[model samples]
Target: MPYSEPNSATLTPTAIFGGMFNPPHFGHLHPLQDALNLLSLNKLALMPCHIPPHKVTPEVSTEHRLAMLALLCAEDRRFCIEDIEIRSNKTSYTVETLKQLKKRTQSPLWLFMGTDSFNSLRSWHQWQSLIQLCNIFVLKRGREALLHFPEISEYMDCSAKKPLNEAQLLSLHTQTGKVVALETKLLNVSSTQIRNEIRTRNESEAKISEALLPESVLNYIHKHHLYES
Candidate 1:
């Protein structure tokens, strides 16, 4: 796609990638890429948070996280990182973020998530109103559930698609109203696993620790001695 210009119908759907991004790894990138292609998004605005309202994960500092994210996305114009949440609030909430985004740009926005997260839609902050704001794009995680939550298919009424490959990613776009579930390829990586490896440093896990994370993040752990402390 050509570089998007002002006052034109930019097909680039700006999918919101909001998180701590403590040190973004390949795991984060997989869904990001899958979401971009699946939703036909032109670009992704990586939203590194202030404090995630939903979870408490002691990541590197927000500034460092944003800097690393910027570094990671530097090569691609399609992926840009935003620190709006850090600038405004101590805690980041998706409901507020989506509402504020709707107020800012004309680019069509979509919220990207894993199938498990989408299934827990109603439990999020002001989640129903969130659906009205942007379409939900879910990437399948795996055959197993991380949280053993109930079978929920109502909050978004998201249509399901079982895609085994990258090309078959699910897609849906909404301009006027209502929420739709678009399906996409499931990336098989987990942040929890990454954090654990860093903390434990077992010989059996050395391969994953060396491969999955970026050198920058590894250096950060050494500098701050995160997992050690």
Candidate 2:
């Protein structure tokens, strides 16, 4: 469960790590760096979710999110921000995106999610087949709760035949269909926290407002007044 990757030495395999980068933060950077360091990543498509289903605040617009993501990852060649979901008008779902990503890359695909996401696997649309198309790499986000959450066990394909354990994560080499867990420290930063700061007081804005996002994104956010609105 260390931060070490279970399958980073493969032949140029790529892992798809998509998220609603409403405002890319340090927390987002950790997994990108961790996955790239731990997995045999040919390329990392940081596809920002266009329209996430359960998000409370609809998020800052897609354009703003994508632009900010681009600015943050521009210097890193291995990491990339794709408009895959943003380009589509339909609500973005993990299964649909993974299928599309599979077509785009010849390398094996690994879906990266955090422990919380994995735990709530049952709640996702088409949760069953989603786990089969590609291997999963779940990074432990925040501290592990004292309680045990086995929601992932209910994933559509989960059965006694394929248990969710460390062996399953490492079996991606030959099986190419499993889940891996990566244990890493949390950054304790979130986009929502930043937005709250901006909403609660004017001072927070000036403190972190030094081009933390892409120039274009900052312009758009200022124009829309997303969180402030």
lDDT of 2 at 210: 31
Q: Candidate 1, residues 1-229: lDDT per residue as tens digits?
A: 1122344243445577676676677677765665565444568787887877777855566666766677667645678877678888556788888878878876556676666676677789887567656655555544533233233222232223432232222223324222334444454556667667768876767666657666666566657666553
TM-score of each: 0.72, 0.73
Whose lDDT is greatest here?
Answer: 2
Residues 133-154 of candidate 2: C-alpha lDDT, one tens digit per residue: 6667776544553223342321
> What lDDT is obtained when candidate 1 is compared to the true structure?
0.60
Worst 10 residues of 1 by lDDT: 162-171
Tell me the alpha-carbon RMSD of every candidate: 6.5, 7.3
Backbone clash total, candidate 2: 2
